[model samples]
Target chain A: MSQHPDSPARSNSGSHCGRVWVIAMHAFTQLVRMKVFYFLAVFAVIAIGSNFFDLPQHTGPEVSGIAVLSSIKSWSLGTMTLFSVVLGIVATALLLPKDVEDRTLYTILAKPVPRVDYLAGKLLGVLLLVFVSLALMDVLMSAVLQIRSSMILNQQMDFAQGRGWSAAEIASLRGDILSQGANASLQGAVFAVFLRASIMASLALLISTFSSSTLFTSIISFLIYFIGHFQADARAIFLESGAAGTGPVTRAISLVVSLVLPDFQLFNVIDAVIEGQAMPLLILAKLTAIGLFYAVFYVIASWFIFAEKEF
Target chain B: MLLAGAVRLPLEASLTGELRAAGLLPAPLAIGTRDHIGQTSSAVALGGLRTLVATFLNLRAYTFFTECRWDDVAGTFDTIVELAPHTIYYWETGAWHQAFNASSYYLNDSNLPSLRRDAAWRASVLNGRAFLERGIRNNPGDPKLNAYLGFLLTDHYKSRAFRDADATFLAASEAYRIAADGRDALPFLRRFQLYALARVPSREAEALALARELYQNRANHTVTMQCVYFSLESHANRSLIDPGSFAVSVFGSAQQAYATLTHYWLRGSEHLPVHGVASALRVLEAQLGIPADKSVFLQHPAQDAEDE
Candidate 1:
């Protein structure tokens, strides 16, 4: 049932890409079932209202397109990312344990599907679902903004040209632009959100494969998320207790931790992205590549540990 | 889809491999301040992207803004404009930050060689030009942005023979026209009329007209309040009669904020006037600690009240 570790290519003739597609579709379907997507759309609407409320409106609050876009990006994208992580983790946790309890894993392993193919499929499913949901929500926000923005431009032109326009008319136009801009911000592929969700889902799957009981997997996965951020702090302690003997001891402890847990903090890019600086492609790629590498390593490690257990 | 390319992560194992190859640090005390950059990094292994790279990017933007590197701040401003084409204040704030704060820094980085002072001044002038350009692009409707842009363009045209003074001044006039012609601008336009009268005396009719509008429009109410408040606060201030107006003006919402705090103060006070006096003095002193000039407003009244 097990493929050799040394070989990169699996002997199974089933296409890895096809299997991944299947997994992604399945994950997307699962996401819809989670009801979190609805939660996100509602939350985004709330964020839009909040942005509207913050406007320095007198006759009415005026907003430019830019303001509307940014508001949507921060409020909607931030909310969506949180939803994705929770959805991904819950989906992975629920699916993994259920498969084991039903002895479904044994039935699947008996087939030609490689362990790598299985792991990749599950993650791909969740990601594709996230993409679809983001696209739909982004479209709705943009359409509303376009109509509102057009009204603003017309009113501003009237005022500027000496064709008398009321202060209310000018303000309403401004408000439209701002509302639209806040909405427009949601159009960017929210890197911080997607990366975070992917890492969390992958980590959850690893926990599921290791723990025999469902309760243990839930507890352990949650702890790993919180503790993973502390990897940098752990290294500080390793250095502080004398770099020779106690240092080596501390270093060993940290290394063991790295080996055992995924570094969740690597996916944190929310603050910089929100401020509107373009993150370099290479830097983002470097982080994602690192994540893919960890995902592969962990899933395979889980497979090895799990294959030995007689379900 | 292309942005997904940014999703790549550097394998931590590469760093791990480097640490294992070189061996350990020699000195024990050296570990306190620093150590082998690679080895200690793994031992206290933070996610490299999360810690080091993100820090560099965030710090770089902050330092440019704080250190008054107008060019760098302008570059960042432009990037932010692109990144958030929808946010109105993002562009306006960026322009203001560059012109007022960041550009001020280029006029001052001590590291510039004495020979580069001429070059630095030229750079500072260039920084102002770039900042105004951003304002023009993002905040075209803003009178302030147009005024700054026109002033900058005119200065460059005259000083360096940049050949754009007419266009720049035209733009400035347009901004002033917007500010002066509008209903909101009426009060401000009156101030200019008054100032012109004080300077040349030929604009007396215009000044009188503006002063009449100030009375009729009642838009000058806030200004009157400010003048009256200062007079009274300064008159009442002393060792026994301190004024809180200066402190409240700093928050700009001092009346409302002090009112809320006074609710708590009222519960415990014996001499209501003394409490008011002490509270006012304490707030004034606290505010004066930083904005020393605000305390200067009290100078005339303090002296006159003492004589009285």
Candidate 2:
């Protein structure tokens, strides 16, 4: 098998890292040209629009403008989750089929390049697209949140001072407003969004290795994505079913489902963060570990299935 | 696949438990709550967009509010809080709608007969109180929710909905105390607690102790505090004390004491205790040499007087 002149394998640099980087960058540029970043405009509109939700529903100055801060976080993070997951799954699903159609896969695989690096590069490219997209959305969210939070803080301060609120009271109010605004936890939540998407992308990559078409891969990945949220519940039923005197068949089914599906509920700390709860660093680190664990396993799994596949 | 799941399942379960312990993951959705949120929202919320679905439902609740659909408004908030239980806004707004908006709507705008209207108003107020209490349970030690509970319990019109005046005041004081105990709570919460405690007949001694502590800070020497302090002190020393002298001792001067007591004496609608206030005023009037017909009591006699 002769390699194409433009292939990374034909170059003098035979390093796996170098080849993966080249392939990943190429994949990133290709996806970027698909205009995936256009979703940021919609996210901007959502983030900016969330400000108007600071409804007059508040009873007093202490709670005023708080609803709007929550609105911003909820809308922004929700949009980011939707965009990242769709981008992760769809972009990864399309890569293999597109490459095969373009004859790029044959050109790359016909050379000395290992299948694992090719697969890793393509997965990394999808992840890079998702990461870059989430980072930009995070920036937009934080900026809008900061500006609105400052306005709310100023308004609340003036009101507190006018009412002769104590210094402690003023500080407490400031703390509440700032908590709802952009902060470290919100960033952790955005990262959690990336983590969840990364899992989906890697899973899609594994599926696409044996998938007959991009449509099948995308559909199956989405079905799994939705079902993954319920994995924890299945585990709970299985674990507790013995004490509750459950039937063996039911217990077996629950156990099978629990062991087979990824428990996406662990990443749902994003909901709590949106509601003004802080995400601790240790938890975020643990979540990062889970994400990497899934991605690495899925990529290796993909490589195994793709290794001997015929063109 | 089974081996992989076996390894990750326990890890995922442990992380879920830890996240929940840290208040980072909300409890699983109850079936009733899921049913209430409907299909699309249930899907959205279950997909980890709970807060976003909550925001959308809140908008729907606003529509329910404008349409004068009070039941729908309350139901919508019930689901909203379930979706985002940690959100103070949802809790606060839910309570406000039931207690203030829905109750007021029943009182003033409902087409029901007067008797049914009154019952609806009272039920709405109680529902609001229940919602706030639930919020307090979900967010234990939260100052704002506790304070809101105190405010609801002490609200003049709403308090009437609660059957027992003494129990209502006692609960209000307890709520206010919790709020006041929180770090960085507003100064006035302590005073409000004192005000509520003073009305609880069995808690007069405790109220007096709190009042004395608050009095040590001169910032708490507002007219209501002075009036409440005087009444509590007078009650404690009822046997040996002369009202005129005690009033002078607490309020600094005959005229000042007389003016403050007279003002407090007339605010009967507020449900503040008036222990020994009438006697103090009678003694002060005699000393001030005000004629019987021209006396403060004769000029504006207490309506629904609560003399002790």
Q: Write one digit per residue (lDDT tens) for candidate 2, span B1-308.
A: 78888898888888888888888888998999999988888888888899999888888888888888989988988888888998887888889989998899889955799999999999999999999999999989888898989999988878789999999999999999999999878898999999999988888899999889999999889999999988888788888888889889889999999999888987776788788888888888889997888787775665443464
Estimate, for each residue in A89-129, the C-alpha lDDT of model 1 and write its tens digit.
Answer: 77677776666666766776676666666666776776676
lDDT score at residue A86, model 2, on the 0-100 scale: 90
Best by DockQ: 2
Say which docking band candidate 1 falls in: incorrect
lDDT of 1 by residue, B29-63 (tens): 12322232334333322221212222222235556
The alpha-carbon deviation from the true structure for residue B62 of candidate 2, after best TM-score superposition, in angstroms, is 1.2
DockQ of each model vs. true complex: 0.04, 0.65
RMSD of each: 20.7, 2.9
Candidate 1, position B271, lDDT = 10
Per-residue alpha-carbon lDDT of model 2 for A161-250, expressed as tens digits? 999877877888888888888889899999999999999999999999999999999999999998988888989999899798989998
Candidate 1 local lDDT, residue A158: 57
Interface C-alpha root-mean-square deviation of candidate 1: 14.9
